[model samples]
Target: MIRLHHCHETRSMRSLWLLNELDLEFELQIHPFDKSLRSPEYLSLNPAGRVPALEIEGDVVFESGAITELLCERHSPDRLGRNPQDPDRPDWLTWVHFAETVSQHSAALTQQHIALYDDAMRSPIVMKLEAARLGKCFEAIEGRLSTPVENRDYLLTSGFSAADISVGQAVYMARHFVRLEAFPELAKWYDRITERPSFAASLPPEGAELLYKRDFYEVWNG
Candidate 1:
């Protein structure tokens, strides 16, 4: 069985969601943030001290994006991945990479506003500027999703894929930092993704304490 070193409230949630989507049984080892991920034991598994590290056949794998790909390859290869032999492989690979890249930028902006920037650095002006930049990213997504209702569903090809899992999680996190209401198409897309059984299951129960808690610089001031 695969062993997942999961940290609550982090990108690790994506791994768990993906595993649940695949219906693969795996061991989950919770690594609470208060416990210090840099501990020698955790470091032995991932020198970077990140969570959602997977131990498969005694080999450790880190990075949420990579782990999602690995799980798809191992368990739900048919559904999660495109056939390399297919002529559409290029488009499939492009969408996969696009999901990761766009989501990274979106998540980075959130971290900047919520955790990385201080009060002196995060003025209203700065916040608006950052919001505008993030808005442009959503605009791009909105354009793609503007396709006719029947053709607008998934981020990847016709059906659900890892792209949806990755991009969906990033968009979910974006709500905490950016106002997504301006983009109707993106908002609709987000609503659909969040309603998925896998996505809904991944979220913590309402009012429940987060799995892992980190000190957000902005939260301290407010």
Candidate 2:
């Protein structure tokens, strides 16, 4: 049996979305995005005490990227994964892992804007810097999408794959902090991928608590 421990709107959302896209049968365990993750019982599944500790049969998988890679390999290698011999393998890996590059900044901004809570505890400098970094990340994606190619609707020239799911979910979180107005290509690409029904299925259920309460966050006012 495959089981995924998830928190609404966290990195785990990527894994959940991929699972939905692959039409996999799995149990979803929703956890409160709080200290309870550090509890010994939870830690047994994922020593890092992070969301997205996936259990498959007797094996366990941690880290969002690893989970994405493993799931695609096991279930959708031809469709969502570019295998070692495929021409797009390198590009696929680069873009898939780039999701975390975008996520690191969002994680920091989340800490500054929400986790810290106190005005004094938040750093406007860190907020501004991270937000700027996210813009740079967006620029990278914009440049990629702008590359001359026919029917370039997805990251990989081949077609939509797990790479899109990984980076798309990261963009979903990053969008809470950065507006897409400046990057027209990136904005269009994001809208296109998210239109898929699997993306809709990954959304936090009604009345579920969310990690990001705001649609947008400016640098800390204090």
Candidate 3:
């Protein structure tokens, strides 16, 4: 049996979207994104107390990237994952993991904008810096997408894969803090990937509590 611990609009959304894309049967355990994660029971599943502790065949997987790799290997190898022998393997790995690079800034911005309720507890400088950093990540993606290639709708030359899902979900979160307007290629790519039914299914269910309340969180100017 496969089970995934998830929280609304967090990194776990990447794993959830991948699972949906793979058409895997798994149980979803929604956890409140708060101290409940730090509880001993939850910590046992993920020492870091992060969302997305996946249980498969009696083994638990932590980290979204690791979960994405394992799931693709077990279920969608060659389709969502390129084996080591494949030329695109290196690029696949790079893009799959790059999701976290984008997410780290989102995570920090989430903390600054959402977690800290009080204005004094939030740092305007940190918010601006992190949002600017997210723009850099978007620029990197824009460069990749802009590379001269025929039918370059996805990250990999082969086709759509977990790399798209991983980075797409990360962009989903990052977009709240940083607009995609400046990067036209990235914006178009994001819209294309997110239109997939699987991506839509990964969204938090109706009435479900959300980590990000606002559609956009503009950086504080103070």
TM-score of each: 0.80, 0.98, 0.98
In model 2, which residue pairs have backbone atoms overlapping below 3 Å?
Answer: none
- Model 3, global lDDT: 0.94
In model 1, where do residues sit more than 4 Å from their true spots?
99-130, 148-150, 211-222
TM-score of 2: 0.98
Instruction: Give the Cα-based TM-score of candidate 3 against the true structure.
Output: 0.98
Ranking by TM-score: 2, 3, 1
How many clashing pairs in candidate 3? Answer: 0
Compared with the true structure, model 1 gives a TM-score of: 0.80
Q: How many pairs of residues collide in model 1?
A: 1
lDDT of 3 by residue, 44-105 (tens): 99999899899999999998999999998889889999898999999999999999999999
Candidate 3: worst-modelled 10 consecutive residues by lDDT:
213-222
Query: In terms of TM-score, which candidate is stronger, 1 or 3?
Result: 3
